[model samples]
Target chain A: MIILIIIGMSLVTMIPRVIPAFVIEKMQFRPWVNRWLSAIPYAALGALIFPGILSVNPDKSQIGLLGGIVAVILAYIGLNVVLVVIGAIITVYFLSL
Target chain B: MTDKAEIYSSTAVHMIKRGFITGIPIMLGYLPVAITYGVLAKQAGMTLMELTLMSVMVFAGASQFMGVNMIAVGTGTLEIIIATFVLNFRHFIMSLSFMNQLRELKLKWKIPLSLGLTDESFAVSSINKDEAKMEKGAFFYGTIISIAYLSWIIGSFLGGVLGDVIPDRLSQSMGIALYAMFIGLLIPSIKKEKKIAVIALFAMLIHALCIQLGMSTGWAIVAGTIIGGMSGIYLLKEDVA
Candidate 1:
């Protein structure tokens, strides 16, 4: 059943996550263990974000490609994220038109 | 003991503030996509109740979009589920990393929180070290999930109703919002590293390669994440270790 699969999948997903908490609840790890753990999140974040932007255009054409560049520039400068997304969308729309 | 309790209570407030601040990006990203997913799910022939159930239970943005697309194309239920799993595999890595921070939470809290974790929450929750490590499972999970859950419900409902009228180009363009939010999330952290430059470069390269290989959109994400992560670990392992 779909319900069972959802539960099963959810459990399978949570196991690697929740098991560590139970084991380490009362224990303290070395600072390095802590630091390495901290490093993983940012690293994972970089892995997740970079590809989404750069993967826009394979041929490096003007429309899709330029839109990605403009968005990245705005994003890099700490522009409002929502604005940057809209800017890219608008730019791409106009270009395609 | 009373002093410690007071401190914990104050820290809980701070954690909630931090969690709320982190949800801003999700708000920006979720609005358009969730709306589109709603519209698309409707277009794909899902009934109102079925669409709501998918949003409530799955709660994943991209996978849900892809799942509906698959269903639209007549993909079987089993295949749709498998595709979703593979696409969401990054959450597996995200959850494992958060496990260290979550070391103090009780099982009752952890079970529900972990189920609610998604790409957006994983990104938001993982960035704030203190929030990520909060042993007060109820507060931590409660704050993150509340924002995410509220946004999905509102966005999905709006999209389902209004999606038909929205233009095609606009719907396609909204895909960029989630990615843009991600860049905003990474700015503060990426500024901290020289090696991050290299890892990002490698991620782009791998992504480009994956596209060239004619892989599906979902598979490309998986490949790029694995390569990017390993590049970071290899580059930072010595310093971190």
Candidate 2:
């Protein structure tokens, strides 16, 4: 039963990825589809990053917001990636104290 | 001398080199996170071998951490598996892009390579403009798996042996590494277009609203994806028009 559940779950997980591969290999995408496909990754990344920036706590407080601001500001100015993160973490740590 | 054999050998070398270079940050970050995963797995009564295999076969970082945490908290297998599935859904989107670009490789190579595609590998590989497609794929995929495999091994070993000594404060600090990496990626994209800035701001607003409304993390991700994706499509259309 456990094996069957794993297999079932894997199939569901794998099919979404595999379908597009078959589609792309077999057919020429419409121009709009191509553009949309290109946008998917950047969009997906934005989705992931924003929430992380907003709340380190369940209450959605000011510290995470402030830290995010510092991080985004530094990131926009072409600061080092490691530095931007260090700055954000420091901002959060200090604000919490 | 067969040219194909030479190409294959060179590709292997490139893969290992790229793997090591791109994996440095991940190596730093993974030690803590993977160890956390291991400790939680052990606390949940998972044998060392079971923990190691999970790391080997399913090297996803966040999901594994959450899975073991859930197990430690006495969650059922069904819930643990479901949460893991939800967390890894992003890989489907990533894999599609990789597959389309990797038209040169056979399924044998592509299958395992696709499984190894993580955010770190995707970020590094997608940025490289000059490498040959198959070689880049091999390199990027190898880079991801090599670090991931090592982290899992070392993390589990450390957790199994020294689980009691690690401080919670240090374990929590690992989260900062991800934010730092994001800042790195964002800076370049921000320079490229005003539209990217707008999309990022828009996504952040939606994320804030989701948090304010008390949405769960999973739902927040869904909301952000929809808002960001729609805004990207809109912005691109405006630019073209």
Candidate 3:
């Protein structure tokens, strides 16, 4: 069962990725669809990042927000992803102290 | 061999080598996180072999973490399968976009490329695609993904061996880094386009509201993305135009 579940997981993840490249190589999405697709990067990033921020238990009120803000600032200046994350973690740690 | 053929082969080889080296930083980032995943799976009563196989087969961080939870609670296999499938459904969108970008690449490359299409790898691969005049070929992406794959496997082994070496405080704090990484990814695009900021803000608001109202994470994200993207089509169109 475990192995089957693993295989099933692999199929679901892989099929979506695999089918498009091979099967739909010549197809182009409609303009509206393309618009929606372009919006995906931002929308998806926002959804993933925002709620998780609030869920982190706060020491002071909404303390994690500071980390989020710091991360955004660091990232904006073209800092590497690793550094951006480390900066946010360090900021939050200091705020906790 | 003809000079043309030799040059082509060397370029391909060079791209692959460059890809592997570029992947090193992503490998570093993934190592600790995959190790964290390993630690979680271990806590959930996974045997070392089972955990190793799970990471190998799944190769997805969010799903693996959730799969460990489901397994720990003795959830049905279907539930585990369904939940992971749902969590990973966004891969459909990502793959579609990525595939279109690779019009120059061959159909045969799809298999391995798809398997390696994690969020981080996708981002890195796309950047390579954009920066080059020539196509970032199958072997280049394969090399990039393989480095990440190898690092993940090594990280899991270390985690299983170390067995919760991270202190409690540090562990909880590490959670913030995931959000931080997401923010880092978005900031570049947001800097490039004002419209993206609106979409991002709306998506965040909608997803948080959905979660507060007790919807599931996967569905909430899907809903938020759709709504936010739709809003962009209507609301930000004027600004963009």
Candidate 4:
């Protein structure tokens, strides 16, 4: 049963992703359809960062907020992405402690 | 056509190397979190085989975490599947977006490639999409996905073994890196496009309000994406006009 659930989860998780790859390109999409597609990443990332990050930590939950701020500041300045992530993690760790 | 084929065949190895190089940072980034997953999974009473199976089959971070949590709590199988599907609905959008760039590749490559489309690889692939020929692009994407896949599995397996030794505080702190990476990815786009800024703000506000109104995480993310993506398209249309 557990095995079946894992398989089912994998199938459900993957189908939405895999189906689109095969289908979307076959249909000649409009420019705005294309634009909205490009826009999805930024929109998804933006959405994930906000309310998602806000509720992350269990202890010292405020650290998530501060960490996000640190990330925004560091990323805004055009630091390397790896550096930005490290910077935020360090900031969150210190402030939380 | 022959020239294009020749060029593609010749460039494949170089693109793979580039993909490998691009994947290194993301691989490094995934290590701590993947390990954290293993450690947590172990703590949740999952056997090593089960733990490995989860990482291998799922390969998604957030969903795996939720899957383990649900399993521990004895949530219904259908519920676990649905929740995970919802959390990962973003990938459908990602796949569609990437499809435009990857149209030149054969169906075989696209199928496997989509299976490996984690958030990290998608960001890396899209950011670097236009740098080279289309085949090269596929190889680059393949490399990134392959390396990330290898590292993530290894990290999780090791964490399952060594999770007992890692201190709680350090493990907890490492969790911040993924969020930081998301911000890092967003910053560049926001710098290039003012419309992205508007879309981001819209998404964030909608998501925050959804949460405040007590919606589920899945629903909140869906709300945010639609509002954000629609507003972005509208803004881009206005800019073009």
Candidate 5:
């Protein structure tokens, strides 16, 4: 049962990731379609961060929020991604303590 | 070998080196999250082999996390698979844009290259200034994805082995790491195009509203992404091509 689940999961996941490469290459999208596709990364980044970030520490959701804020500030100030992540981890650690 | 062929090969070598080096930060970013996934999946009763297989086969952090959580609660396999599909459907868009960006490459590279199109890999490849111009750009992009992919697998394996040794508070704190990385990746883009900030903000609002109405996180993100991208079609005037 577990193995079946894993295989099923892999199929669904890989299909979305792989099919576009084979299909999209042969097709030509209009300007608006390309615009929508181009915007997806930013949209994905936004959706990935919010709501999920707050719930990372469900018991004290503020810890996640504070960490997110620290990350934003550090990233805004042009810190390298590694440092920004480290800074957020430190903030969350201290807050959780 | 002809002089031009030698020059092309050397440039390809250079780009491959650059790709691996550029992947370092993403590797760093993936380690903690991958470890977290390992630990959580283990606690959820997954055997070491199962967790590792999931990491290797699925190769998606967020969906793997959700899959394990569902498994822990004894959710049906179909439900879990459906959720995984919805959560990962965003990759279709990413893959489309990514292939278009590297259209200079042959079709043969796109299949394997698309397999590695995670959020972090896609973002880095898309933002790279020299991506379109490099010789063997597929190999360069593949190297970047390969480094990050190796880190994920290694980190998950280590986490499975070292599960009980890691402190609870520290692992919990690591939960914030992936989100931090996302912000880091997004900020530079937002800085360049202030309109991107609006797109991000709008997506967040839509996601929040979806959650308020009792949508699953997976579906909500899809909703937010589609709606947000549509908003961009109007907000962004520049030609994407």
Candidate 6:
């Protein structure tokens, strides 16, 4: 049963990812559609970070928020991406203590 | 002929090395999150094989986390698969945009490249300005994806092996690392084009609203991305079109 579940999950997950590469290159989208598609990465990044971060530590959401804030500051200061993540982790670690 | 061959191989090697260097940040970001996923999946009663296989096969962080959570609660197989699909639907959009961005590459490379199109790689690739100019652009991109993929597998395997040995507080804290990476990636873009900030804000608002209404996290992210992306049609300047 578990093996079946894993296989099913892999199929569904890979299908969406794999199909677009082969199909979309042949077609051309309208200008506005192109613009919308280009905007997706930014939007997805936003959606991925919020609400989910707060709930990272459901019992102490502040830890996550503070860590996010530190990340923003570090990134705004033009720190390296690895350093930004490490900075947030350190903040969360101390806060959780 | 020998000189040309030597030059070609050296360029490929250089691009591959550069790709590995560029992927270091993503590898760092994925490590903690992947480890956390491993630990939680173990606690959720997944055997080590099941836990590792899921990461190896799915290769998606958020969906994998959700899959394990759902499995732990004994969710039906169909439900888990559907949820995984919904959560991962963004990859479809990202893949299209990514392929379009790198349309100059050969079709053969694009197919394999799409398999590694996670959020982290997509962001890095999109932001990278020099890919088109490189002699082996597709290979460079492929190397970036390969390093991230390898790190995820290694981190998850390590997490499973070191599950109980690691303290609880540390693993919980590592949860913030991925979010931080996202912010780090998004901010530079936001700084360049203020309109991107609006798009991001719109996504955050919609995602929060969906969660407040008790929608699943997978659907919420999809809703937020689509709706937020739609807002760009109006808010984005004509220059972008």
Number of the predicted model whose DockQ against the real structure is largest: 6
- Using Cα atoms, each model's DockQ against the true complex is 0.33, 0.36, 0.56, 0.63, 0.72, 0.73
- Model 5 has a DockQ score of 0.72
Task: Looking at model 1, give its docking quality level.
Answer: acceptable
Quote the positional error of residue B167 for candidate 1 in Å: 4.4
Per-model TM-score, in order, reads 0.77, 0.77, 0.85, 0.90, 0.92, 0.92
Clashing pairs in 6: none
Tens digit per residue, CA lDDT, model 1, B56-150: 76777777777778767887667766767767766665665665567666666666566677777777676655554445535755687678877
- For B61-164, candidate 4 gives per-residue lDDT tens digits of 88999998988888999999999888888788778877766777778888988988887878777766564245457778888889988888988898898885
Model 2 stretches with alpha carbons more than 4 Å out: A1-23, A57-63, A77-97, B1-19, B101-106, B123-137, B206-216, B237-241
Q: lDDT-based ranking, best first?
A: 6, 5, 4, 3, 1, 2
DockQ-derived CAPRI band for the predicted complex in model 4? medium
**Winner by lDDT between candidate 6 and candidate 3:** 6
Which candidate has the top score in lDDT? Answer: 6
**lDDT (C-alpha) at residue B100 in model 3:** 59
Better of 1 and 5 by DockQ: 5
lDDT string for model 6 (B15-127, tens) is 89888887898888788778888888999998889889988898999889898899999999999999889888888888877887777787888888898888888877766
Residue B134 Cα positional deviation in candidate 5, in Å, after optimal superposition: 3.1
Q: What are the per-residue Cα lDDT tens digits for candidate 5 across A4-90? A: 889998999888888878777688887888778778778888988898899879988888999999999999999988899899999
Model 6 lDDT on a 0 to 1 scale: 0.85
Q: Candidate 1: deviation at residue B23, Å?
A: 0.5
* Residue lDDT tens for model 3, B1-241: 6998888888889888988866765675677777888888888887788788877887878888888888888999888888988887766666765675565667777667777787667656654554233654676777888888888887887787788887666656666776777787788877877778898899989998998899888778777777876766654443232
